[model samples]
Target: MRRLILLRHAKSDRPLGIVDLDRPLNDRGKRAAPQMGAYLAAEGLIPEAVVVSPAKRTRETWEAIQSALTGPEAEVVPSIYEAPEAALLSIVQTTPDTAGSLLMIGHNPGLQDLAMRLAGSGEKAGRKRLSLEFPTAAVVVLDFEGDAWSTVAAGTGRLERFVAPRDIKIGD
Candidate 1:
């Protein structure tokens, strides 16, 4: 089984002079990113490879998360920045087969759509929550039956987990 983790970029600060791609994560995002990382570690959901968007906030989110985890090869692909669902799908399909678990840190609409499209079966509650909105600093874990990443297609995955920063209780 192959696991795919889709993480939305954390909350960002929209500074007046900065372009959308250049926006940095806000204080809340800074806090949430690590919290999410800790949650991932606690749940034993480490990935073998990580794919990220080149945007500032997405990169920063990955950096914070990387601090809590170990030994995942990562790359920042420019195409993932504001990419459409089809473009994101293409990127995932081409991922090396050696990596059993793949994590992607990117922006919304695309990420949300990809998660919804790929998940054909899973817990009803998780799917219901996913349909509402994919919040910032949230993660959706999907398990695909096939071994090869190239064969992964829409409606072939089962939504294993859906976690958001709000769902995490850090100090507990």
Candidate 2:
């Protein structure tokens, strides 16, 4: 089985004069990003590679979580910045088969849609939650039955877990 972690970039500060792609994370987002990473680490869901968007906020979010990630493999892909769901899907499909797990840190709408499309029947509640909106610092874990990322398809993966910043803090 291959695991895919869909992570939405943490809350970003509104760009006053800052360009949309250059806006950094707000304080809350900064705090939440690492917490989410720690939670994932504690739960033993480590990814072999972390694929991230090159936007400022996404890069900062990844930096916040860097400490919690066990391995040293991470790639900042410019294509992920403002990418549509199709682009995101393409990136996932092209990932090497040897990598058992992947973590994609990117933006909303696309990420949310991808999660809903891949989720299994048992995760109806989580799917419903995702259908609303993907909040900042949210992580959804999906388990694809096939060994290769290219074989992933709609409804073929089960939603193993879903964690949002608020839920993590409440559990703490």
Candidate 3:
């Protein structure tokens, strides 16, 4: 089985004169990213390989997540930034076979749409929640019944869980 982790970029600041691609994560995002990383460590959802979008906010989110837990081999893929579902799927198909699990930190509604499109079944409540919105700093863990990433197709993955910042508890 191959596990895929889809993480939406955390909240970001819309600074005047800065382009959207260069916006940095806001304070809340800084907090949420680490908390989400903690959740991943607690749940043992670490990936063997991570593919990240090259946007500033997404990169900052990865840095914050890394501060909490570090293991996965990551790379910056320029195509991931603001890509649509089809484009994202193309990226997934090209994943190396050596990596058992893959993680992607990117934007939405590409991530959201991809997650929804790929998931055929899973936790009922989580599926319902996912259909609504993929909030910033949210994550969706999906399991596909294939050894090769190239074999994954639409409506083929089982949605293991859907988690968001609000669902996590940060210690005081």
Candidate 4:
């Protein structure tokens, strides 16, 4: 089984005069990112490989999460910046065969759309919540039955879990 983890970048700062790709995460995002990372560690969801968008916000999100996960080095993929669901899938399909699990840090509606399109079933409540909205800092874990990433396709992954910062109550 192959596992795919999709994490939408945390809430980003909307500073005037700054391009979207260069925007960093806001205070809340800074807080939430690590918490989500710790949650992933707690659940043993470490990835064998990671692909992240090069946007500042997404890159910052990865940096924040690294404190909690010892996953492999992340590859910055420019195409992931504003890619749609299909494009995201193409990236997934291209993941190296050596990786048993992969993590992607990116933006949405692409991340949300990809999660919805690939996940056909699993936990009912989580699926329902995911369909509603894939908010900032939200992470969806999907399990694909295929032996290789190339064989995984739309409507074939099972939603193993869907979590967000709100679901975690960590004290400052």
RMSD of each: 0.8, 1.5, 1.2, 1.3
CA lDDT, every prediction? 0.93, 0.87, 0.91, 0.93
Model 4 agreement with the true structure over 1-172: per-residue lDDT tens digits: 9999999999999999999899999999998899989888988989999999999999999999997998798999999999999999999999998999999999999999999999998999998999899989989999999779998798999999998888887554
- Output the better candidate (2/4) by TM-score: 4
TM-score between model 2 and native: 0.95
Answer with 2 or 3, whichever has the higher TM-score.
3
Candidate 4 at 36: error in angstroms?
A: 0.7
Question: Per-residue lDDT for 1-172 in model 3, tens only?
Answer: 9999999999999999999999999999988898999888888988889999999999999888885666775799999998999999999989998988899999998999999899999998888889899999999999999799999899999999999999888664
User: Which of candidates 3 and 4 is the stronger one according to TM-score?
Assistant: 4
Instruction: Give TM-scores for every candidate, taking all chains together and pairing residue i with residue i.
Output: 0.98, 0.95, 0.96, 0.97
Clashing pairs in 2: none
Candidate 2 error regions (>4 Å): 170-172
Candidate 1 wrong stretches, greater than 4 Å:
none
State model 3's lDDT. 0.91
To one decimal, what is the Cα RMSD in angstroms of model 3 from the true structure?
A: 1.2
What is candidate 1's CA lDDT for residue 63? 90
